[model samples]
Target: MKTLRFVASVSFGKDSLAMLHLLLEQRRSLDEVVFYDTGAEFDCIYRERDRILPLLEERHIKYTELHPAEPFFYQMFAHPVHSRKTGGVHKHGYGWCGGSCRWGTTYKNLAIAKHLRGYQEKVVQYVGIAADEKNRIGDKCYPLLDYNMTERECLAYCYEQGHEWLEDGVRLYDVLDRVSCWCCRNKNRKELKAIHDNLPRYWERLEALEAVLGNMKGKPLNEVVSCS
Candidate 1:
């Protein structure tokens, strides 16, 4: 019989941070904490990871970081596309990922799955979904939901623990709902507008990508810049 290994998947977001804190507080048996880096996350997300590193070290919890085999830009701009009709290859990349075609999510999951395959033990992955997000609950173990913690409660708990996602005197939670990949095409207009207004460098990069890729979500990047 193989041993069971308990692992927590963290994104350094409010829910995940709260879940990790609760697991620690309750003295749960945690073998490791795994984080899948999308390579395009906001700076605050990385900073939050840095903030939590000491606690993981203090508790002697193994921390593993997994990254996609291909870079985000390469997947977006240079990936080869095979044409079924002509039996030829199109060098143009997959363009902007959105809806069900989110390649970033695919890459992240694949990387994590590949890493977990290395373990001979049975891996019980703990996700950080909140009670309010019951629709997102799957087969994974959700500690926050088990504790009846809502999304708002999770954020409150993280703030109470000094796990606020802050960058340049700006609180990220105040502007955006999720701190996922910065280049994600699924972001709403409000989130995109916030980035356009606050983060010029990132906005510029988005504009550059849009220039090369033509349009995203059937709209010009300038329209997002003028979002009210």
Candidate 2:
């Protein structure tokens, strides 16, 4: 019998890293590792990527970097829908994404999943949903093998693998969460505040997109957000 062909979606976060570590422990051979990048991601993300590159190099893991066909920021400005909210800040007018409304605009997340679907053989996608965040793990459209391990388990796996120095003396269990774009709607109150405080220009642009749309009360994104 042939071994299963699997692709591990690596986010360079604790959960995803843990999933990869678990696979390595099982002595499984991964066909590939996929990563999606939207141009608007944070500088810290790039630094993290730098750190991840050597780790992948050490492990000789094959990975692919997939970016959007169209530039996300360019599309944001070219369309009228995203144009109107150009400079406003604050969640009310600025189009910041949160729990109720995600701005319906996560290009990278879905794009990565879609790209994974095109592989030649049957693919088992491994997602980094934590045990504490069971709700984050959902019925994926394609074939998926999910493991909802806890944050503690994720860090412990890394520590067991001799990555204690990489933990940066930070409490791994508490700091094992993923980092994403500053203006992303999936963020919590603290994340939003951090964006509003640090990246005012980006925050303003998001607000402008929302102001242009005018319906913050759970309306369909198609009606409010138009690519044209």
Worst 10 residues of 2 by lDDT: 164-173
For candidate 2, what is the lDDT? 0.56
lDDT of each: 0.86, 0.56
Best by TM-score: 1
Model 1 steric clash pairs: none
TM-score of each candidate structure, all chains considered together: 0.93, 0.61
lDDT by residue (1-228, candidate 1, tens digit) is 999999999999999999999999999989899998877888889988998899899999999998777887888888887888887885668788777778888788788888888999999999999999999988889999779999899999999998777766668788888877777888888888887777778788888988898776578877865865
- Report the C-alpha displacement of residue 107, candidate 1, in angstroms: 1.2
lDDT of 1: 0.86
Candidate 2 ranges with C-alpha deviation above 4 Å: 1-3, 80-106, 139-148, 152-178, 194-228
